[model samples]
Target: MLLVRPPGVYRAQEDTSLLRQVLRRRGRRGLVEGRSVLDIGSGTGALGIEAFRAGAADLTAIDLSRRSVLTSWLNSRLHGIPATVRRGDLFSPVNPHRFDLVLANPPYVPTADRPPSRHRMARCWDAGPDGRVLLDRICAGAPSALDEDGTLLVVQSGIAGEQATLDRCEEAGLVAETVARARIPFGPVLRARVPELRTRGLLGPDQVEEELVVIEARHG
Candidate 1:
């Protein structure tokens, strides 16, 4: 997909690709055909574009970054697909509107003391302390934003507590499980925080890689 990412917008990476792959597979099985789709924390709008290509009847992309909103809008136009791109916190811009599918690749990277910044690039991956800030919020709120029989797919690093996410989803009345996983080398951020993570017991002493897991939750 051709996309224009400004300085502060997140570049499409492994997590993004993982979600897209799942979408493609589900699309082929006709799960996404003509369904209403919502892409939260939309960075470059890649997932929204994929949802569009998957024959989503209605599409919406939301991001906290203004640059991301512009980039997403441009990308949707470039792809000749109709999508509502809005600059706001996750789910805020599209409240009272539920969808058949909700996709999220929220900030799950663990940061020491600082919370994620809404106006900065670090907001793309900085989750507070245990990295549950956005993930937990999404888990708690997603169920309310999904239509009956809707599905929500979220990608997060294992270090951020995969089981915690599942537990949260299940608490929200959804059946959740890890649908896909990929082991990849730690990125610069994680590499820099290895010591802190190790001290916090989130990572093993000799761990050098991180596992990305896609959690799929469905309304029961």
Candidate 2:
């Protein structure tokens, strides 16, 4: 599918594809067929578009960046998928409404530098020290935003503490497990922060790649 990612909107990366792969698997099993979906951090509306293609009945998307919101909106239209795309942080834009599935490909890159990075697209991947910035928030908020049988799928880097995310999801009243995993060589962002990742012990000194994991959570 063609997605228009303008100057500032985040370009779909491996994490996005990973999340969609897991979702497609579930869809094949009839789990995502005809279900309501909420896509957090919609970026380019990729997940939202795929959700409908996988048989989702309705779609809602949220993003913090205005450029992303517009990009997602346009992409949805271009794909002929009707989606409600809004600009806001995480779940706030869709409060009180619950869905059968919640999808997220949040920023899970750990950074030594404090937040508010001046990089043009840092918002796309710069998570604080341990990389739980958005992961923790999603773990905390997703449960409440899900229907009784709702499922949450989140993709993140292993360095961001996958176990921590699972624990938080359980604490928030969900049963969580790692559904998928893949190793990717460090990208430019990660390569530049090798020293910080080493200092924080997030990776082994010689580790040249990071594992990406997709976590699945459901109401317990």
Candidate 3:
């Protein structure tokens, strides 16, 4: 699982690993076999590569950063799998093209910053105030991007409101729920935002850990 992770590009962390585990589980259940897969905000392209190995018939990955797109392409090549990697905002590059599966590990850190930085590194994790900038967009666009029976597996921090994600998907005509969850120690970003998050009522005083959840949304 060696990958070329250039600086300023996101390095796979606990959330990434959790998403990978879910992908593997779904693959084992034959959910990903011969399906078209889309990996949004594809950072290092790890999830797309996993889908390819799991027998995805077609795989496309999109990212907002050129470095991330290059990294994804390189990693796909390293694994001898062909992936269509493009640089653009989420779902913009592949509009009107529906997929059987969509995977995302988007930026979900609640930041006080009004708008997230355009810097390559900061773009990886700085979602605005409530951390739903991209999450909300994904939920809104997922129904249109997915085939009638398609499924979406997206991971986000519980601090960002897991129920909101499920509600958004449901509103979009998908059945959504938390499929997996983990309690992890706050990362550097969350640790630094403790005071602000507490003041915003998003975090409890003395809370040192955060829960991460993998949301599975399926079109009926």
Candidate 4:
């Protein structure tokens, strides 16, 4: 299998365990077959590329990282599929159009209390220090970008204030559920997350929880 890599200040590990769980639960219910799809923050285009394999005919992938856009284009070439990968801020380059499926995996690291240099995509990773910044934006903007009955899938950390994100989605007119959850070991970024969580009282001063909660949501 060709390795799938997302480029940026920080590249995601070469794994799709969480995404697979999403497919297992919501894939059949979503517009996977012969539908138009948009991937926001489409790092390396994993989810969108899978949508194509599942039968989505049109795909538009957007990411703020230029390296990510280039890598996505390369990955699409390797997959023998045509995808439009653009480098732009969220929804800036996209017109207000409805899509059968809209997917995103935003950076959900809260850094309000932590040092900034620890994260590469400081803007992407720091979501208002509670990690809900980008997630909230996506939830709020997704309904307008989705077609009637369109579904939006997003993955975030349990520590990223997952419940708050669900609530934000609901406020934005979408119903969300915890479709999947996984424990990802502390990576380079974990060093920073540990202290932040400790300060926030989410974890004991000496205890560090090494896991993230992933959720999938659908628009009504």
The TM-score obtained by model 1 is: 0.97
lDDT of 2 at 190: 90
- TM-score of each model, paired residue for residue: 0.97, 0.97, 0.98, 0.85
Predicted model with the maximum lDDT:
3
Query: Residue by residue across 1-220, what tens digits does model 4's lDDT show?
Result: 2645654433544224576456545547654777888888877677777778777888898988777788777887789879988888777788676788887878776676454343365655666667676788888888888888787777777777778878988898888877677776565665766776687765566554555666656765
lDDT of 2 at 127: 86
Pairs with backbone N, CA or C atoms under 3 Å apart (clashes), candidate 4? 34-55, 112-129, 158-213
- After superposing candidate 3, which stretches have Cα over 4 Å from the reference? none
Q: How does residue 78 of candidate 3 score in lDDT?
A: 92
Best first by TM-score, ranked: 3, 1, 2, 4
Return whichever of 1 and 3 wins on lDDT.
3
Ranking by lDDT: 3, 1, 2, 4
- Locate the minimum summed-lDDT window of 10 residues in model 2: 111-120
Q: In model 1, what lDDT does residue 78 have?
A: 90
TM-score of 3: 0.98
What is the lDDT of every predicted structure here?
0.91, 0.90, 0.92, 0.72
lDDT of 2 by residue, 30-68 (tens): 998989999999889999898899999999999988888
Cα misplacement distance, residue 68 of candidate 1 (Å): 0.6
The model with the greater TM-score, 3 or 4, is 3
